[model samples]
Target: MRFFISVFIILTSIAPAWSDETRLDYSGRTVIYHSDVKLRGSQKRDVRYSHKANFFGAVAINTTKKTNDSNGAAWGYHNLKTAQDNAMRSCRFKADRPEDCVLYLSVVPKGFDFKPKTRTLSNDAVEAYNFLVGWSRLNFDSYRSFAVNGIHTWAYSASAPTREAAEKEALEVCEETFARSQKKKDPAWAKAVYLKEHLQCRIFVTFSPV
Candidate 1:
């Protein structure tokens, strides 16, 4: 009876935490986003590898100051992303089979063109990204209107073929996303403020030392 009781305690102790790790995982996948956010396009995402440090993911906002031939504002938009709600979650990273790897709940800023560059990468990073983008684009295709401080944000499908059309779609999303930062800053942005709209967005959440 005592041996059976000991086994029960051991299993009980291990179960919850293990279940917690399984919190983000369903089947063999890492679940990063909640059941919201809309995604579109080819909708296929590929993961990139990172080297050195253990940085899970980094959120980046693309800045647009390269358009003017004089100022050279050609880079793209500038905006900030939100942090993940984790206290209600089981773990910081996605829960999966490996169990120890960390996943960055990346808050991708709107209009940040995630064009891939030929940089050095790592195997784990490659593995992690492979899992993450699949999840993120799903959120994007089915995104919800996140209302921050009364400013409601929503994402629309990108209208293609023309750069001008892409720009319009990008500005629409960025304007909404920009509202998040603006709300955090007490809702202050003049009509005169320059908005750097992007015609493309490419998020590269790889494991690298940047």
Candidate 2:
């Protein structure tokens, strides 16, 4: 069965909390989150203009310093993935530690809303989903696929040139992983889980360049 998983993966554990947490903008069309580091006059102007001009875009900033002059913004992109990638690329260009760059805000059109596939997943599954989505976004020109057994067990294919190849590989990896875990005699819980939720792997999400 096909499952459409949207963005909005839980990042509580993966990412550190921002000083200024994410919130809906007054206009209700934008979602924004700032950091402890204040933006300079030019940076503020750039952010204001980008949000106003683009229907979909993202902003990233280096949050490790009080004066975060290293920032990036991408607007007028066809998809959020590309916008996010470009923004991060721009921010990392100037960041002392590239890993310090974090996505600050993402703006979508007024009517856009994210709908998740399911909320009953375990915390580890949710984190896995986030990792899959993040990895897919890193390369806008590649096709990627993820598979899940409707529980904590999941796997993803590396970026491939074609959708079919990516999907096939993801399913293979997921099924193989599930099968391997079932034979682990050392972990009693593993065997128990395998018996309780022995679901077959199915394609969960697919990413294609816009």
Candidate 3:
């Protein structure tokens, strides 16, 4: 039995499809994402433009701003502190629920042009996140929804301002994407986001405390 189990484990590990990459998840919680996208609408523009506008912004804004990438993240945290005193006060789990449950919040964040070839959003010295929680399978509920943003198709970023700029852009995206987040003040970062020439897509994460 031990030999068989060992063989099975080895076979599965050697399978062609396993990767540590966090693709296909809105926030990669290992399971249960409010956002999940299998592929990009366009490879060149580097975005799913329409989705970025409402989903990352509006949804996060609508909920308590427990996490915000723009407008000073600390401000968002302050709002969440206030929600506990107001409307959400009536939620049932506020009293007897187990406090040990862990939760995670992720936003579709970005990487800058000059950020070294291997450095990422989470740098060795700088913690880029606005909020991070120790997560567990027990802590939360989940939902997934995608509206018909518009026609879908392929697009790419515009020709770079210079060859030097283009090369830098590619490298930055490659390195930054390895561990990126979803927060935006504007759409300049993504070269392609949707089926159209002029749009962007973004994704964000949030959590509600009991």
- CA lDDT of each prediction against the hidden true structure: 0.23, 0.57, 0.20
Candidate 1 matches the true fold with a TM-score of 0.20
Put down candidate 3 lDDT per residue, 125-169, tens digits, no spaces. Answer: 022122122321233332211111011111111234433443343
Worst 10 residues of 1 by lDDT: 4-13
TM-score of each: 0.20, 0.40, 0.15
Evaluate residue 102 in candidate 3 and report its C-alpha lDDT on the 0 to 100 scale.
15
- Please estimate how well model 3 matches the true structure, expressed as its whole-model Cα lDDT: 0.20
True lDDT of residue 20, candidate 1: 19
Ranking by lDDT: 2, 1, 3
Winning model by lDDT: 2
Q: How well is each residue in 56-159 modelled by candidate 2, as lDDT tens digits?
A: 56677666542435566655433445456556666665677778777776666555455643423333444666876787677778888877764335677757
- Model 2, backbone clash pairs (residues 3+ apart or across chains), number: 0
TM-score leader: 2
